[model samples]
Target: MSNVEHVTFKNRDMYWEIAADIYYPPNFDESKQYPAIVVAHPIGSCKEQTSGEVYSAQLAEQGFVALAFDASFQGESGGEPRFTEDPSLRVEDFRHVADYLVTLSYVDAGRIGLIGICGGGGYAINAAMTERRYKAIATITGANYGRVLRETEGSAEAVIAKLEEIAAQRTAEAQGADWQVDGGLPESTEQAKELGITDVDILGATEYYKTTRGAKPNGLNKTLRSHMGTAYGWDAFHLAEELLTQPLLVVVGDIQGGFGAYRDGYEIVRRARSTKKELTVVKGWSHYDLYDKDEPVAQAMSKLTPFFTENL
Candidate 1:
């Protein structure tokens, strides 16, 4: 096991700071340059949960320097009107983290790779498309937020209606009204059932986020209501077939429902123009199972470790 150090750095081209944890392999030597991996968390999650505690920790143990960081306006990072989930800014955050990694003498700048979980997985793919710094990319239950929103809303008319509502709320806030925040998961699985949220994905999310299994104080699980409209119109996989040329790995569970990761994973694998790409479907596992479940995580790592090793 390796010790992780908590740190913060200014986000380039942005005013606020980004908080992160850097994991060093056991018996790490600063004098030697090592390949590094950037681990990005799911939406409504912080570095402390699966990103840093699980994936980053394991990647470091496998002899690579792994970084897990909070996105610009979420987690411990400094930003105004927090919990904003802007897709463009989220994609840019990966490049900014790569900038920081390159300045470190212990990191081999040319061998940097990425691991994105849930929504972060989608952003990671988008980032890697334009930014060549990431030599390889892997997504665990990767989800495109915009596509998911569009699909789950049932119709384009419904999406537009929601966007209209968001626009009105933003206008109201600009006129000195109080900001409206979206709430997180239900208090418990029972409460979720009562709310009629029976989808395996949402139910699993409630269980993971609301319980001791994956809860962290900074993983507030809320988002600014006004900022969500940006995701409705954005697409994480836009032009992926043309611009995504890096070695790619997509890992997803078999179970499917409200959350679109399972389908999105296959879609990305199908769309990416990467010369070397692979998709591993974890049988019998739901989308959230890969979040922290021992078996699923192990299965994902088995593929990820080799993919990164071969590519990076």
Candidate 2:
């Protein structure tokens, strides 16, 4: 019923195959090259879970060549120590996708763009900084993973201390203890409840991550290798000093828990020397609103099409 077609392409390594769904425009022309957009999913989620397919399908109907693929070590991609998370490798995965995109006869290499959702947004920005392959980058309900994990909501020093503790845990695992990562969301203490983050936050996130709404068996979260910190160490703000030459778009929902991060990122980009950037805060939308069938999805696409159309 949709214009999208399932496809698979081999990465540089034979074992690292990219599983993607290509959405063709209803009026697609075989002889014409089209602007291409690569959609990346969130950490611990697949191309399917966060509705990357839905976005691609919709973009295709709008006359773009949109491709959504699973990151290596997640979903249909092949990697060892399955479910493991690596920031550098994830960024490389995006680069590889860009490389693959340029090879497509129907793709216009100069017009390639990227859209990252949730955690993937962080990866995409980082990728743009180093990859320079994407002509434009856009993020929805974006997150800066390194900042979120290393710096807590209140105090940076206190958050770093906690990260050091997590590092110690990784050390213990390397020395042969079972790799015991946090199972689910932490139990909400009384103090947390006072802050309005009752048990509901944990429970809701768990349900979202563990159900069909946002779950993939192979997309389960796993502890990073002990050395992974070296790659994910730099906060998203670290790159703020560098000029964002390409057009950047940041989209956030008003009600998401991590909405503040979106603002933080936008401010950083605004400070950059780049003149081509825009930010949109969707009112009455929650964190998960951009993930699936929420009204904000339509609002996001409406804004995204024009931005990429003009920029890419």
TM-score, predicted candidate 1 vs. hidden true structure = 0.98
Model 2 root-mean-square deviation: 3.8
Instruction: Name the 10 consecutive residues with the lowest summed lDDT in model 2.
Output: 182-191
TM-score (C-alpha, index-matched) for candidate 2: 0.84
Candidate 2, position 77, lDDT: 80
Per-residue lDDT, model 2, residue 1, is: 30
Per residue, candidate 2 scores C-alpha lDDT tens digits across 1-312 of 357777777778535787887778887876889998999887777777664656777777778899888888668887755566677778788877887888888898999989888778878887887777798988877787776665443576765665576698778977997755434343324434555764332444555676666666655644544434554465654555574567888888766463354566566567645578888988886666677765888999999999889988
Off by over 4 Å in 2: 13-15, 153-204, 219-228, 256-259
Q: Residues 1-312, candidate 1, lDDT per residue (tens digit)?
A: 337988888897997889999999999999999999999999999999999999999999898999999999998998888888899899889988998999999999999999999999999999998999999999999999899888878999999999999999999999999989897678888899999887999899998998888889988788899988889998999999899999999999998868789889989999999989999999999988999999999999999888888999
Tell me the lDDT of model 2 at 50. Answer: 66
Model 1: residues with Cα > 4 Å off, grouped in runs: none
Name the best candidate (by lDDT): 1
